[model samples]
Target: MQPPSKPAPPEQQATEAGSVTTPVRGALASLSLAMLLPALGTSIANVGLPDMAKALHAPFQDVQWIVLAYLLAITALIVSVGRLGDMLGRRRLLLAGIALFAVASALCALAPTLWLLVAARALQGLAASVMMALTMAFVGSTVPKARTGSAMGLLGTMSAVGTTLGPALGGLLIAHFGWPAIFLVNVPLAAVALLLAWRYLPADRGGAHAKRPVFDHRGTVLLALTLGAYALAMTLGRGHFGARNVALLLAACVGAILFVRVELKAPGPLIRLAMLRAPVLGAGLATSMLVSTVMMSTLVVGPFYLARGLGLGTAVTGMVLAAGPLVAAFCGVPSGWLVDRYGAQRMGGAGLCGAAAACLALSLLPASLGIPGYVAPIMLLTASYALFQAANNTAVMGDIVPDQRGVISGMLNLSRNLGLVTGASVMGAVFAAGTSDITGAQPAAMIRGMHASFAVASALILAALAIFVLGRALSKP
Candidate 1:
């Protein structure tokens, strides 16, 4: 089912003046839709975790691990897969990822047990990693450099919309159809995206079939170790702050050292460490981690607060909880535009400031007040998330040269997920600690903790900014 990508009448290909046809537009739409599929599944799962556990008869931590495992695989493999895509063929890899994801998703929907579901989800993550790490590259392939910004801006908002819609959609599916419905939703989206990707997306035509592939095994291993160890510490450190936690942290440090060494020595490293020396890329990646914590924390606490604390139904909670990302949807495009026009440093700073202010507002909410009381803060949080994320993405991707773009994108994506995992652990602990003492009124206390956690998260954002500033200072001419 190859697409009819005729050389567009030599004159059209030669001159940029020839407007794209409806067919080409459909093709691009198909690619854009494909770009968004993995996110839909991930977002749905985040809000539907409780329902998933009930259906699978799993414990809370185990259910959490299901999500973690997917992320682990994605984070660990994205960098390697991404660069490989650049060297080989991004569209080919993307289609492969789409097919793999569809099958894994089917497995998840029909899983007979929890373990199977976990394994399926890990495969899904791997597929998602490929899609996310290379979709932007795909955009570059489809559109000229002049049109890339608008394409990127639209894609950014599309992600925000997907994320915002996912929770509500998942909740609605779970309410009547049960947890499997959430996974099942992917069947149609993936099927269509796969079709378009197969038919429309162009082939990669890089420096292929030339130099021997210098696979960076050392860099790969060290990165896996670093992220894995850090995730382990976050997942386990709570309730037992002892030798185990220390060892995990030490392991992370060791892996960081090893990874730096590998990047320094490899002929063609997995992630070019020299790129990290760029202010925009480094700052963007650092901020990605910080903003991700906000998502992790919000996902865990928001559902719980709406369902258990306020006694609102999960369905209602899903609707209410979609606000943050919905706001993100509204702001994401403009933020990308801002990143293009202004320096990433300035834009990133502005977003951080907004986020900090939002957190302060969240902290100020009293238990006596209701959801409306929190609405303003939530809106701010949403706007800030959209702005920061768009800024970071543009900055990070903009910093790198074309050849290494995929791997760099993967690394940046990994940073965002790493932030999410970190946020989940830290915020979960904070909320848990805050609720430990109370018996009947634990709900109120939990809200209090979540609010406070937002405060702490805001502080972390500032810390990230400080790092960005320091990096800038170090790079002074």
Candidate 2:
């Protein structure tokens, strides 16, 4: 299962003409599949949540916790696991993650109670964090740096496909088989991914190197506390805004300060705070969070408006919802090529501006509009995100050294998960507040709520764009 001879480093591979050999192609394929699973799992669960609620007879808040728990685990553990992968072996950690994810999916499928399902999902999410943290590093380490954007584009395409197809697929399965079908479907696919990874991905030569940095236990603990408490406060503070939520938020603030202090003093930091001092990396990470927040807010609200408010069937809703990511998926490869040909700054800025415009358009849509009204705006929004993701990721990774790719990958993923949690919590609360006084039958109220959510998302995206522009301006010589 080892490479016949040690392959040249990625930077060296980039210089050789036509270096995408069979082994390289194999590695990309393996990484793409690994990336697809988590994205699909997340989207499928979003589509299937109502069915699970009905099957388990759980309250709305309880069922929402299933997604929240999964997100929290990933946000808390991603950086630590990523550092471990870099120190140990990325291939080794990725395989273990794939296996554990498969088992956890089975656990989720078989869980008899809602709490058990949440627990299994949390386990599944932890495994997903590992994959998320290392998959980009795998690509960077295996593929040539010259073609990094193209490789990332392909990976991005796979993720967009997962997001694009997941709702439709989940709706079909749930309608015919049940909510559990969503979980069961992952088992065989994960088994296949595990096999491919075992055969194709490169072994970590760095693992044999002595003088590896020590694992930062204190920094890891502090980061976990910071992310965990923040996620908890964001998730629970909506309706249950009590002393507990306040305390948790305060704890998160303290934990963040402590984490910074510990990382500065630690011999081996979980995340190199100094790396974030680089404008490209920091701005890229922040932009990712903002884009994800906007997208997730729309995702959380759009389906509800379509299904419950408009009385559309799940199948129809899924089809309508798929349009955005489908466009994004189709554009992914080109977006990457564009980043390589031009530059990340240009592409990233253009994407953000497009996204802002789309968000504004969505906010202006009225209650009387049909599914057709949303198609163009959704497509524009998701396509913009795809463009931004491909370019921004390339920029961030390109700036970092080879050895730090794993941690950077984890940080990128951490930003996305945190954004999702924040968006879902804040946007859901906004929608709920907007519509709370009206009866469920009042579709207009729901539409108003949806518009409010979009408006808030638009404002956030604009703020993000402002920050990005300001940072770029300041960084100029």
Candidate 3:
């Protein structure tokens, strides 16, 4: 026989292994739209709050619920819906979610009263929870294991793009069409996502003889209640903590204890405690939360420093704020490539090191250097964040058993959400304390607040780095 033909090139081999299959590309498109719509929903409405309040004849506080209702529903119900998807079927549930989201978006656009709009937003949030939680879970089945990092990176990029596009797009839509246009835009996007998902996502694999998993109703209710209470405690009253906040926080703690007690005894628990005991999964979630907290500091603190301290105009401040997500969107895919080449653990550590360095630079750099100094560090921080997110998600999802993927993905999203909520309150408070009165603070005071806030952020990054290192060491055989 003739000598064996030379092996295929890496790209061809990857294609043969199904990474670039038509069905895989279709599935990825479906997942990308799913990720994008939720992120767009989250940020797009903020720019239209004034218009909404004027149209609905409501105060700013009442109009704010149009946003808060959506956020609260997603934060509370994400894990419960994910578990339900595992018991039912992810594909079927995702299709239902997309359909529901489309309907809710239409309702939001047509609502005549502020309360009605808020109710529609709540419903939309429920749908978004399914899309967000299940999209990452579906990644395991859609793409080859070798390309997990790439897929994760792509999803991250889409998320960043949605966030970056929302304010600008919403402004244009509202200026020309009205506030409702922002919600109405989601309808067509959801239809496209639904069609792709229906056509290409792998069908749920189980026969009539298959023993379906039981749903843990008690655990689900308790978890939802606990999370709702905690979210309310963190978000209500803006940044000022009060007696009501304390009471709500205490109730959440009690609810959490009850939830754990119920889960431990349930025959079919919503989440198995043993899974969290795994060092890699636990560390990944913890670091995700920490990194998210640090990242949110940039949002909460950056605007004040840029506008008040640096004396930038409104348009300039907005442009400067957009740069972080822009850099993150561009870096996400390359970061995934690095993860695939260098391994998740190594890439994760390197990302954390870079993040810590960037945070330190932000803390120490003088305000005299102005926009360039601030922008440079923020870009570095965001790029590093993209690398860490890709590596962490790939590592966590790489080996999960198929049945548990939905809940695990939900937990990952939940951790990041909670961190964002916490950072908004905690970091805002830290900056407020440093400045004494932020509204009338001098430039020097604003600089002080910025320094203090970033110093704390740098500490948070170091803590995440420690957790990552410790987790890897313990995960070793």
User: What TM-score goes with each of the models?
Assistant: 0.84, 0.88, 0.96
Model 1 has how many clashing residue pairs? 0
Worst 10 residues of 2 by lDDT: 9-18
Error of 1 at 117 (Å): 2.5
Q: Between the candidate structures 1 and 3, which one is better when assessed by lDDT?
A: 3
lDDT of 2 by residue, 1-477 (tens): 976998865535644754677778778888888999988888789878888898899988789988877878888999889889988878899999999999999999999999999999999999988988899888777777677788888888988888777877898998999989999999999998999899888776763666777999999889988999998987785534589988998999999999999989888888888878777777878888888888887777888788876878978987787777779889889988888778888888988998999999989996567887778888889888888888888878876676788888999888888888778777877787777753463777878888888899899899889878876876677
Candidate closest to the true structure, highest TM-score: 3
| Candidate 3 residue pairs that clash | none
Lowest summed lDDT across 10 adjacent residues in model 1 is found at 9-18
Candidate 3's displacement at residue 200, Å, is: 0.9
Top-down TM-score ranking: 3, 2, 1
Model 3 lDDT per residue over 11-112, tens place:
345445955777788989999999999999999999999999999999998898998999989999999888888889899999999999999999999999
Off by over 4 Å in 3: 1-18
Inter-residue clash pairs, candidate 2: none
Name the runs in model 2 displaced over 4 angstroms.
1-11, 46-65, 110-116, 174-180, 206-208, 237-243, 304-318, 366-370, 432-448, 474-477
Cα TM-score of candidate 2: 0.88
